[model samples]
Target: MTEPLPHPQLLLAIAALRDRALAADSLNALGFSIANDPYPLLQYHQALVFQQQGQSLELLCVSGLARPSEDSPYLVWLQRAVRWIATQLDDDQPRWLGRDALTPPADIAEGWAEWWPKGLWCIPLHDRDGQRLGLVLFLLDAAPAPALQPLFEGLWRTWAHCWASFARQRRLLRWRPGKRQLLLALAVAVALLLVPVRQTALAPAEIVSREAMIISSPIDGVIQSMQVRPNQPVEKDTPLFSLDETTLNSRAEVLGKEVAVADAELMAASQRAFDNPQSKSELTLLHGRVQQRRAELAAVKAQLQRTQVRAPRAGVAVYSDPNDWLGKPVSTGERILLIAEPKQPAMLIQLPVADAIALEPGAEVTLFLTAYPLTPLKGKVLETSYQAQANEEGVVAYRLLASIDGQPEHARLGLHGTARLYGERVVLGYYLLRRPFAALRAWSGL
Candidate 1:
C-alpha cells in the first residue's frame, strides 16, 4: 500500500540527496583516468596521494601525474609532514591545517613554509578494516577556500576509499632506513671490503712439450712400415718410419742405365772429335749432356736416402698410434709426429675472448687434467697472446702458455685439462660484480 505523498520540500530534499549520491558515484567511477584531467590539477595547483606500502608509505601521484623516480626537493621538505602522518591517531579523518600552525621540523622549514604560506587541505584515507592508510593533499591559496569542505564532508566514506585503493596499487616512492637496518647494511659493506678474493679466469688447456720438434714428411710417399711405435723411447738416428721404396729403386735403375749410356756416347764422341775437326763442337755438347744427367741422378739418390725417416735427436716419438700412419699416403711437409723430451711438459691454454683476464708473467695457474682430476697441477704463466684468434675448436680465443712446476709420471702429450688463471687480489664485492658493473657502464655510457 502507498503511504501519503511526501511534502514538496521533502521531495526536493530527497532529489538533491540523490543527485549528490550520483555525483559521488560518478567521481569514484572516474578511476585512474583522473590522473589525466588537467582542470582539477590546475585548480588545486597540486594534488598528492600517498599510500601504505610494506613497512613504509609510497607516494602515488602529484598533480594528476604519476610520481617520478628521481629524488626531488619537495620530498625532502615533506619529510616532517610524513612523520606526522605516521604518528596520527587511528581514528583521524580529513581536516585543514594552516601553514603557520603546522610547522615542519627540518632545516629548510622556513623556505618550505613560505612557499606554502596559504596552507593545505589534508584528507586522511582509511581502509574498511579501520587501518590508517596514507593522506591525499591539496594545495590551497592565501585566502582559505571553504568551498571544497562541504564536498568532502557530505560524501560517503566509500568515496574516499577509492583514492586509498588506488594509492595502494602504485609503485613505492621512497625508502627510509631504520636504525637497525642502517647498522646491518653498514656492517655488510665493511665485510665486503675485508674479504680477500682472487681475480681469476678459466680456459681449456692441453699437455705440451717444451722442447719438442715436429717431424714432417720430406718427400711425398706412402708409409711402408712404422720402424718405431708412438711414445716409444728412441735415440738419435733411430728409424721412425719407412716410405715405400719400390718407386725409388725402379727410378734408380733407370737413372743408372741413363748414366751408362751417356758415358758411352761421350767416349765415342771423344774418339770422333779427334778424327774429325768439325765433330769437336758435337763432342763438347755431348760432355755437357753427360754432366746434366749426373746432376739429375744425384738429386734422385738424395731423395731416396730420405725415404727412411729417422729421429733428429734422442726423444719420445709422440704420434698417436702405428695403425694411423702405416699404409697411409703423406705429402711433403705434412707433420707425421713430434719428438718431445718428456723432461719438461708445459700447459697450452686457449683462453676464450669472453673469459680473458689480465695475466702477468709468473702469475699462478691451477690446472686439473681430466685423467687425474683428483690431483691438481700447479704452473706459472709464461706467455699470453697479443691478439684474439680462433683455436682448434673454431672458438675465438687467446693463446696462453704456462710451465708446470713439476712433471707427472703419467703425463702424456695431447692430454686435455681445465686451467684457472689468477690475475690479482681484489675486494669481494668488486670481484663478484666486476663483469655486471662493466656491462652496466657500457650500456648506460656512464
Candidate 2:
C-alpha cells in the first residue's frame, strides 16, 4: 500500500516555520520565532519558550510579544510550570501533558484553572549531539494526534540547531562581566594610578666646564686664525685666537705719522720762541697738539695689542670646529671659546619647555652618555634658567647646569649625553597626565 500525501496547507505551514527558524540571527530572535511561528501548523491558545539552564529551565519568550515581561503574572506562572514539568520528564521527547496528570505545588495549582487550558503539548529540544537545548510548551484545547509527533519533533530539532549556533555566537561576541568582578578591577586600577612616584624629565645634555674662563673678542673685528685646536691643553698666556690686524695696523701707522708731524711742528715753535716772543705763545699751542696726537697713537697701539687673544690661565680649549669661527666677524665681548678644566666637567642641559618639570637647586640628576650609556654618571642641579630660550637645535628650552658627583675618566669637555633630572615626588597619575593636562590647558585656555 502507498502512504497518503501530506496536506498542502500543512506542507506550507511547515516550510514557513523552518524558514523563520533559519532566518533568526540571535537567541532572542530564535525564541520569538519558535513561540509564534508554529501557529499555522498547530493551533494553540498560547506558547512559551524556555532555555535549559543548569538543572532548571529559564523562560525565554512568550507568544504574541516581542519579549516576555519579567513581572507579568502569566509569564511568572508559566516559568514555574515549565521548570517543574522539565524536571519530571524522563527522556528528551515530545508528548502531550494533561493538566490532571500534574500534581503541581500549591502556588502553581492555585493559578492552573485561571491561566491554562485543558492540556499543553511539551516538546523537548535537543541538538544533534543529544545535548538538551530547551523546551517549548503549547497550550492546546485538545491533545495533538500521535501521527503529528514526528513532524513536531523534526521542526523543534531544526530550531535546536539554530539555537545552539546563536548561543555560541552570542558568547563569543560579547563578555558579560559580573558586577563584583568589574568593581574590583576598577578599584585596583585606581589604586595603582594613585601610587607615589618620583617625577623625572629628560633633556639633551653635554659635559661642559664649570666656572671656566670665557674667551671673547676684545674689539669688533674679523677672526683671522685659531692658534689652538679644540680640546687642546694650554698654559697661561698661550695664544688662542687672533683677530684680523690689517685694518688696526694701517690705523696705527697713520697715527704714528701724525705724532711725528706734531713733534716736528712743536720743535720749530720751540726753536723760533727765542727769536720771536710771539713764537712762545705758538710753542704752548704746538705742545698741546703734540700731546693730543701722542695720546691718539697710544690708544691705537693698545687696540693693536688686543688683536692677538691669549689664554689667561692653564686649561683646555673648548669650542666647536675652528673652521666655523674662521673668517667670521665678532663683536666686542662675544664668546669665542672656553678655557675649561677637563677634570672638572659639569653638565649643560637644554631642557625643552614641553618636557620641563619643577626643578630646584641641588636636585638629583643622572647623565647617560651616548658613548658610555651602560655606566650612568650622577650629578646635582647647580643652576637653572629663570626663563626659557631657544637652543642650538632651535627648540625652546631652559638652560640648566649640574655638578658631577665625581670625575670620571670619560667625562671630558664637549662630550654629549642625555640628562634625567629628578624632581619632587608626585602620584603616578599626575606624572603621566602632566603633559596632557598642560597641553589641554594651553589649547582650551583653562
Q: How close is candidate 1 to the true structure, as a TM-score?
A: 0.57
TM-score of 2: 0.61
Which residue pairs clash in candidate 1?
none
Residues 1-446, model 2: lDDT tens digits: 98677678776778778888999878888899989888866789989888888777888888997766788887678767777778766777777878787778888777778988988888888776777888888999888866676766668778888988976786778988899999999999899889999999999999988869889999999999999999899999999999998988898899889999999999988888898998898887888999998998898789989999999999999888999999999999999999988778899999999999999999999999999999888999999999999987899999999999976888877878899999999999999999999999999999
Instruction: Give the Å shift of residue 366 in candidate 2.
Output: 1.2
Candidate closest to the true structure, highest TM-score: 2
- Against the true structure, what is every candidate's RMSD? 14.4, 14.9
Cα lDDT of model 1 by residue, 116-190, tens digit: 546566666667776666566667664333443444344325435554544445424445789999999999998
Error of 1 at 129 (Å): 6.1
Runs of candidate 1 with Cα error greater than 4 angstroms are 1-183, 186-196, 321-324, 327-329, 437-446
Candidate 1: how many backbone clashes? 0
lDDT of each: 0.73, 0.88
Off-target runs (Cα >4 Å) in candidate 2 are 1-176, 442-446
Worst 10 residues of 1 by lDDT: 30-39
